[model samples]
Target: MSRPRCERCLRAQDHCLCPLIPHLQSRTRVVVLQHPSERLHALNTARLATLGLVNAELRVGEVFADLDQLLATPGYRPVLLFPGEQAQALVGYAQEGCELPFMLIVPDGTWRKARKLLYLNPLLGELPRVTLGQVLPSRYRLRKAPEAGALSTLEAVVQGLNVLEAPGCFDQLLRPFEALIEGQIRAMGRETFERNHGGR
Candidate 1:
């Protein structure tokens, strides 16, 4: 028989992280533009990130017809978190003390799919783009990143929130993410995981 699953976290009941994860609200709002295909990905952390925030929203689409309305939420400045040559690092801006509350738009998908979210949605492209400054190595040991400094969606959001708000945001926000990775490693066998992720 198939294991029971938690409809909310989408994790099997044995691995459900909901009870252990606490809800956190921030001054900034999270808006995830998730690819439809990533909805069921085992390692997807976008949902975890969204669940942590009180003023967060998750919208799935290749091109959002109502993106303009979403972006135009009064009293919040929409900022797209995408790194590239054209994007500005957020650390200095935070230090400079920009006063507007940000509506953070994060695209959840593969590199190619994330880029498509930017291109297909004209509104996303026009938003102010920001990136993390010198991210530490990702803690997602289960899946190798395509390149160095590539963080899971949850990591990026946590770091971004840290920049915009204060340090230590990562601690509360990463609890669920860390739990998911640990559960996966336990399922894979602790000895095998330790041999690879820890010194033998």
Candidate 2:
């Protein structure tokens, strides 16, 4: 049999829906530290996040080797987006008078890889960790997470921007993810409305 079609965007073999990706500009930048394993996966949300946000950057590697170089980038604050009681909640930075340029760093991979990234990267360990307080469900249907509220890369970016009170940017960055997922769902003859949510 031929290769299986994408359940979300029913493109034929080699004609994936990822090419139609869109990006949005925001005051805050999004940096996706993706695992090499997720680079080609159809269900990887880092691709979706990069497609959705113009300012988003995707780095595929096991560790952030150039951590200092990334930190030296002009006009950008870096915050790791992860959920944990021990993590430094993001509410502190949401206030005014904070730095103008900042990056929301998200590790894209399985829980094990994500934990490894966090543990191995000394620079990342130095930065403040942010967690989402809202208890909701994930939108990534193809993948499974241990936690019910685990969000995809796209959803995490949207929520992070919203926490920064940048709705326009959030909506802008979210559109392409929405479109791509919807396109895929429609291509598979699935209900578009059902998969409109951010997490599966």
Candidate 3:
């Protein structure tokens, strides 16, 4: 039989993450487009990010029918948090003297799946793309990063917000993510984690 779960954080009731989740607010809005494949993953950090941030939302899908309406949200400039040759550093937005806040649209999935999100949503590809200046190392100990400086969805969102807002402004957002990671490491046995990932 399956174990009981927390209605909110979805962890097993005994291992609930609800207590660590914060209800913090940010000037920049965060919208995470998560692929369905990641919805039930043991370490779905995207969900934690949305739950912690007051001005965030999580949408699960391969293709969104109302993406146009979603992107058209007023008073905030929509920007894709993806890297590319044309992508500008997010820090530059402030220097450019743009007064509007940003609606950070982040794709939450594997590299290929995230790219699929962009391919499937042509409108997302048209947005101004922004990249972080200097990315910190990922704290997602359970999974290997696809490339250098890659981060989990929650980490990416926190870094993006830190760049857009003030440094350390979104640090509290990582509490649950960290707790979840620690919990996983414990569940896996420290010997196992140390044996598998300690050298990295």
Best by TM-score: 3
| Model 1, span 77-142: residue lDDT tens | 898999877898877335768777889999999999999888898788888899998797788987
Encode model 2's per-residue lDDT on 1-200: one tens digit a residue.
77877554344446565555564677788889988888776566677677666677888888778888987688877777886767754543446568665688898888888888888787887777778767356555545567777777778777777767543445555555565566567676565445653234
Question: lDDT (0-100) at residue 191 of candidate 2?
Answer: 55
lDDT by residue for model 3 over 44-132, one digit each (tens)? 89999999999999999999999999989998999999999999888844665788899999999998999999999899999999989
Q: Which regions in candidate 1 have their CA more than 4 angstroms from the true location?
A: 92-94, 194-200
Please give the TM-score that candidate 1 achieves against the real structure.
Answer: 0.91
TM-score of 3: 0.95
Q: What is the lDDT of residue 95 in candidate 3?
A: 61
User: Which of the two candidates, 1 or 2, achieves a greater lDDT against the reference?
Assistant: 1
lDDT of each: 0.84, 0.70, 0.90
| lDDT of model 3, residue 133 | 88
For model 1 the local lDDT of residue 35 reads 95
Give lDDT for model 2. 0.70
Which pairs, if any, clash in model 3? Answer: none
Candidate structures ordered by TM-score, highest first = 3, 1, 2
Span of ten consecutive residues with least summed lDDT in model 1: 164-173
Question: What C-alpha root-mean-square deviation, in Å, does candidate 3 show against the real structure?
Answer: 1.4
